[model samples]
Target: MDKRESKIPLIRFPEFKEGWEHKQLNELLKVSKKKNKDLKYSKEEVLSVSGELGIVNQIEHLGRSYAGASVHNYGLVENGDIVYTKSPLKENPYGIIKLNKGVPGIVSTLYAVYKVKDNNADGEFIEHYFSLDANTNRYLRPLVRKGAKNDMKINNEYVLHDRIFVPKKEEQKRIAHFFNVIDTKINQLKEKQNLLEEYKKGVMQKIFTQKIRFKKEDGSDFENWDNTTLGKVFKIFNGYAFSSKDSCENGVKWVKIADVGIQRMQRENVSFLPFEFRELHKKFLLKKGDFVIALTRPILNGELKIAEIDDFFHNSLLNQRVGKIISSNNLIFIYYFLQQQWLINSIEKNIAGTDPPNLSAKEIDHIKVSIPKVKEQEKIAKILSNIDNKIAKSINQIDNLKNYKKALLQQMFCY
Candidate 1:
């Protein structure tokens, strides 16, 4: 209990002054060898471990059971049991471990399940301890042996041999509870964001279908929406075919096909072109408030790969296979209409049977859409924009909470 001689977390509760004790995971947990031998759990109870979502119902998380033909050989996971998947993830290359807080489920043989040996250690605390990617990778990388196929070669029992620092049972509970509260807040914000998105989707459907309409400032009804092809109302200009040699480390930002996301631009791994190229590629330059869409693999999950240019990407040169939308009419209105499911379906139908699905300027220009008057368009855009602002705020709050939790994990645990 000597503060100077023992290991301690960077952050600790005032009531707990003692340093954390170093103990092997084997001393705290035992491998669960229980199998679903007697058909106790059905294939419907199959579970999967996600680095972000922890242990979740396989069918619910992935939309279908990736289970093998037989369920009899699956591993049984009881409530509070720890499960480790040998499958590598982008964040956790060695695999991931999670504690099952939901109903008892069965996982594939690829997973190794465990149970706490006694009340001396907390399973949730252990899960959180390994929550940080670096901490988990540091602990598992050395112990794991890779097979010829790059699969993890360690067995269930050997996985628990590593040692880790742990607090007393009381401190463990406190830390776990504190993280649980943060997790709850994050989940609530996520739920709110989801609901707001769903609400916007429903409202958009009603407004576009004319099930609902916006009245004029004088309380009079606006005219019916006009049906017209995209080509008639807007010009679809394809980006210039910039070569890889044009790419540079520092210069004008280049907007490639990969930069376009659903309603936003992805700034990660961004490429740049020489600043002077901005003048050479004047037609390819995207300005603030410009609407752009990916022409290569344009549709994903029933949504168009479209984004509105922001200040950060203003005057950025656009690369090939991405289209810039220009219209004299309400540009924001057109942007919102392009997001409609029906438009996406039409685009898909046009590109059906095509490999590496692409959307040509001609194809996009040919799609028909219903549009209201400019005033009504402005009203609709304002309404949708307000909802989007709320959704964005929720996303920002959730990300902040996750970052906060990540920071807490770094300090609260003895790495």
Candidate 2:
């Protein structure tokens, strides 16, 4: 490590030129051990601290507050209180440090709550630095000891004894303020993306249910729809079964049921077929705009993963238990229709009751669907696609913003 006296960050605000000094956590905050004596106290103020999200309302985290009525000896916490959970969370098998603000609440004894004692230290700034540093858990890991439960954890003593580097109050304010602004924009982008997705869902419902109708060349409403089986409209081709022995480092990339998502193939967990076998299964090769579905465990995620293939999707080989939906009619319409909520629920319930966990291609093809005129189908698909494109663009922007914030975090803090 560089000399503590010369502890400069990779990037600085230029206004302040002094090197940052390292300080143990005990110098800044100490564990707050105040407890609730009144079991029936209305100051239940239950809250939870998530690894990434920090402090949040308990109801929001657990659907309902786990601390119902009569929560005794619960730790009392106020706004600006810092909570350190020494146990492992879901994705974070280590621990998380957080600052609770505005959402004044109570947490369980399981959490070691601390309060800032030093006037110069900023709780939010400290929390942000620890969060940005990936080794935060490791730094605190030594504090952890085996508890009655299987999980190991640090106690209040260790939590209060730890230390970290903190800048002067003004500098801390500048850094915290910068991240806050970026966070606000990120939240706004996410909200816009979510609203657009919800709007598209409503639009899909309207079009599929005939609440909204498309017109003909003369501007007249299209004729009544015809009820037909999916098999009648489209040819469902199940993917080829390539053995594990045929799997290779490089060759045709094969998509499995696990790779399929309603929006698109994730393509991350995809396996590849041996180059030798690629020549024999040319017809099995998939191309752009090919609509596909997961056949086995079709309803595993509550809804099926239906997606249109990307033109440049690598190799694009289809594996068994996955299938491509083919139609001479408008392909986009079929893709959207399959995603209709009520239709999917009905299919899932049917499959859940009698069918094995696995659904066969024949069962899927037998499902009934409403077929509108080709022109009307084309119009509906176009409208939905436009909304989907907007949502996709917003998501891409949010991702870029998150990446930029990550880069800033890496540069703005010292080791």
Candidate 3:
């Protein structure tokens, strides 16, 4: 190895002095061999394996059935051991868990149990470290060779042999502790964001219900808002179906209704359709402020989202399942208003069919909304937008903390 000054900051602890030592993950850890039997239990312990954390009692998963249910034949797990969900939803590739509850439980064969060898590495540090890196899944992913595209099944054998890196013992604890603090801050921010969302919801309900009123330039009330159908205020432009084969490696961005995530549109990692496909789906060209709502899904079945295309989103095409709303009303105000619990409930009530419920343009237009003057709508939109900005900032802070924790993990272990 070429001798060079390390660019990374080194920690000086009371008990440790060396910069750090590197080692293979197999050197400091061993995988569990206790096989889980298929025997069923009448009064099972209700154990579940957390993706980053080890096995915990039934309460952790809220008593959800895991891997088709089996008895407690598997070896018991302790705190700080790493256990993963063998089958995870595709969108959520990493699954979940970075900490474990020290509780009595057994895991299914679907879970791979990794425990740090005695004092060779800090279990807490390793747990936090492995939790952060998606790279670990690089090896673990291929093991999941079967199941649905959304939920693929993985085996323990694959995870147990997966190679990982580790750092010196002292560095492990420091890094884990450092990341844990950052994680706490992230969780706190998330809680604050949730509160802000709740506050906005409450305000929306009050403002729309006439509990709070808006005044005009003449200082007169806008009057009890008129009850209007959706079609009256806006025209719904349904997107055209573009063939999947027409999608290109790099071309004009296409917004499938699925591109609208649970909260906002995912501008990055967007799929692209070629110019020829765009010609075929010319009517689906999306404007900057267009509200694209998913009309079909069990995934986002009850979800309504507004897409805010940035400068980069020019020439993007919207998919047929997405309905673009061009409103005479303030679009942001309408978007948040639809996000209100009451509106979602109302829309959900009118929903028909069981096998993947779909909403039609007529059904969308029939959804009733209390309409205020355009000016008043703009005012309401401004207030809600401020709250959303705060929420967005908090969300960003959470993301930063998660990134910090992940970085700390990579540095903590010696492999």
For model 3, the superposed segments whose C-alpha errors exceed 4 Å read: 1-78, 88-106, 112-118, 138-168, 217-220, 275-283, 298-301, 354-356, 404-415
Cα RMSD for candidates in order: 2.2, 3.0, 5.4
The best candidate by lDDT is 1
TM-score, each model? Answer: 0.96, 0.89, 0.76
**Alpha-carbon lDDT of model 2:** 0.77
Candidate 1 residue-wise lDDT, 62-94, digit = tens: 999988888999999999999989988888889
Candidate 1 stretches greater than 4 Å from native: 1-5
lDDT of 2 at 192: 98
Q: Is candidate 1 or candidate 3 better by TM-score?
A: 1
> Which residue pairs does candidate 1 place in steric collision?
none
TM-score of 1: 0.96
Write down the lDDT of every candidate, Cα atoms only. Answer: 0.88, 0.77, 0.64
Query: How many residue pairs clash in each candidate at the backbone level?
Result: 0, 4, 7
Model 1 residue 77 lDDT score: 94
Evaluated at residue 52, the lDDT of candidate 2 is 60
